[model samples]
Target: MLIDASSVAASADEIRAGAVSGIIFDMDGTIIDSMPSHAQSWVAFVQNHGIDIDVPDLMRRTTGRTGAECMRELFARDMSDEEAWQHIAEKEQLYRELFAPIFTEVAGFKAFAAQTRARGLKVGVGTAGDRHNIAFAFGHLKLPTPPDAVAGGDEGLAGKPEPAIFLEVARRMAVPPERCIVFEDAPFGIEAARRAGMRAVAICTSHDAAQLAGPHVLAAARNYHELIESKFLERLHVEPA
Candidate 1:
């Protein structure tokens, strides 16, 4: 369901009144503008194996899923766990290679992360990317220090549209799900956040804002810069440092 801007504001107000204390972010599209690179890598990988799948369909089906899950879904065949891991590793290596030179964070993300930390809000990462991808991101991107907690797909957590990853992040951060707000770029991640009993803000990095809209979302922004400009974080009533 597409929510109007007024409804977004209302949801933000409601979340503020509810006392949000922590924030969880999804990595790929939410923190870094690497979706296109990722999609390109997927296309290259599949084509190399003589598989013919549309890039858009690949992205839509796999965005918030682990590489192993994505591989299985894309191939529509079962493989041994070892075989799955091998495919995941190779594909992610390709992703890292393709993404390294052009790596960039979402606009205003570094400053916003620092500010969120300064404001005493716990920060957590809930992502479907494996640890290698997470390491690559942190090692290459010009962002703030690592988040207080991280829950990745490699941890055996169920991927997005299922609440396990988000729930695990909230747990590791010592924040209750109800008091945590999630920042996500995919519809599946938004659904996962809501299912975990948290409010979500959509980062429209990969999809249009309207495509991301749903009842559980508080607002949608192109990047953290827009959120900051509009005082969206302030509306959460985070304490000053």
Candidate 2:
């Protein structure tokens, strides 16, 4: 991984030489600090419903799954899409209410995304979050501009740990998967990037670096600020496309 100056510099050189043209960010923990709120919402949702489920374990299991996938996994049963979304909407509404007052991006996330665009790298979001959650995050984040492309969970793609979501983002960006870099905060996302044949940079917002580590991971940082400190952006030599 790009943990030191030389390695970070080398990876930048490799990136430039590799002609990496697109960067896909996982929405929840990578772009915004929403994981904690998600966890809290789950606890509240279950408590309200008088369910005896293990919330933390549920979070661990469902972190990178689609809402329907999460619901099915949570209850360990197959569910119609309409039935799944009904539950998902209720839980996510709780999440939005809990998160709205405290919404914040990972440190330097906006600046990092802006820098990528300035360097001519297309920025996209590949997220397990559904469309409503996407709107919720953006309504609060207020990025300087929207991503070049976005692939949300509600679109029927299999979620992280599956390459479909990230691959779709690459397709929408009109960039080959091998020419994209995925910024992710979960182990499932790192694996998804690998499956998509894209390089990965782990944003360790919730999980430990060890949990997110993989051969495909070029770097792991607590936030974009650390990546900036590593001078990663400065070494990128991509020009406007």
Candidate 3:
């Protein structure tokens, strides 16, 4: 169901002519190149608990899921709320420690964000990462401006492929689902955006363009630099502030 880049480019006029008014970004892989650290943390966490798992397989299954959801899936057992939270906290703490020194934004993301804001478009972040990870990103990245809305997994929203997180972010941004575009790095996230009735651009950071392809994906790019160079954002027809 994946369309080619040319087709997406051909839809530029339609996108610019009122089809999109907001942009929602997924945090870990899409906004920042921290998935390696995340994967390592997951491997370390599972091994520490004496569980054996293939890191890549585990990552694919849990990429867009909440920590609690991931634990249940990983262990194949139901857990009390308190136990789930404890494990999530521990795992995320390890992830932070591993990623702290090397944290970096995806190439050209900051500039693109600034341009989007200058065009007066609503901007939001929707992520399966918890509040602590969110705080870590804000502290390290030092974004030029805070997002208009942020919907995180710790907020008790259903995770990706369910549409709840993206839907909530759109709501908080005061934009309708059909009028927004989502940037994502995972298949589940792409599905979530489509289920929320929005267009999506795949960020091929953690996965290749082929792996990220799907019917709802408008385009695929390695970073914002490519998106800009290819006129992807120009297709949105945002005017200068």
Candidate 4:
């Protein structure tokens, strides 16, 4: 988790001009430290069902996908929404159970979020997690300030790499895509931000920064602590709160 602070700061030219007005975030790995628990739950779920599957491959294939999409991809079958929910619900419960004890935010996430808002940025969350997952996370995270808006996968929207989810969040925040910056951890989430005409900050939690990088990526850091140390918000010239 050794992030190059200078390189991270030098890429913030887009933010330095006070052009960005909104910040959208991806949840699981980007905000909460839940990816490892999600992975473990996937393994246990497969084992409990006596299914033979490569957990790592499954993670890569479905990490940023919607619940229905994950079910369809995992089984290679076209499932009705009802069927998908039935299956995914059980797995999600397992994830919640496994993650509850270890529920924690990425280092410095709360402070950074407060700082971002204090600098006059509207914060929102656009995550592939379903409503239940969102509720579960928020219940545990108890963030000092909740996001101004949140769009989840259960909204019948396509997930990451499609840009629909992030676009929906931006629409809710009333911020033009070009004026919003997405904070994401997965490659698909980063690509979704790019497709949505938004720039992004890569959170190197579940994947390597290289895997998440793109022309629209403004910064990459291991956690909010690194971003704070690098003066990420301080460098951004934003409106007075």
Best by lDDT: 4
Point out where model 2 deviates above 4 Å.
Answer: 1-17, 237-241
TM-score of each: 0.93, 0.93, 0.93, 0.95
- Candidate no. 3 TM-score: 0.93
Cα lDDT of model 1 by residue, 1-241, tens digit: 2234565545555657677789999999999999988988888888889998897988898889877788788889987767877888988888999999998999888888987887789999999999999999989864557788999988888888899999999999988898898999998888898899988999988887777777778888888887777767777866321
Least accurate 10 contiguous residues by lDDT in model 1: 1-10
Candidate 2 lDDT over residue span 37-109, tens digit each: 9999999888887888989889888888899999898778899999999999999999999999989999999
TM-score of 4: 0.95
- Between prediction 2 and prediction 4, the one with superior lDDT is 4
lDDT, residue 7, candidate 1: 56
User: Which tens-of-lDDT digit does each residue in 1-241 have in candidate 4?
Assistant: 3376555665456557547789999999999999999999898888887889999998888888899999888788899999998888999999999999888999889889998998899999999999999999898889878899999998999988899999999999988888888999998899899999998999998988789878788889999988888788877756432
- Evaluation by lDDT, superior candidate among 3 and 4: 4
Alpha-carbon RMSD, candidate 2? 2.1
Highest TM-score scorer: 4
Q: Give candidate 4 misplaced runs (Cα > 4 Å).
A: 11-14, 239-241
Off by over 4 Å in 3: 1-11, 237-241
lDDT, candidate 4, residue 33? 91
Residue pairs with backbone overlap in model 1: none
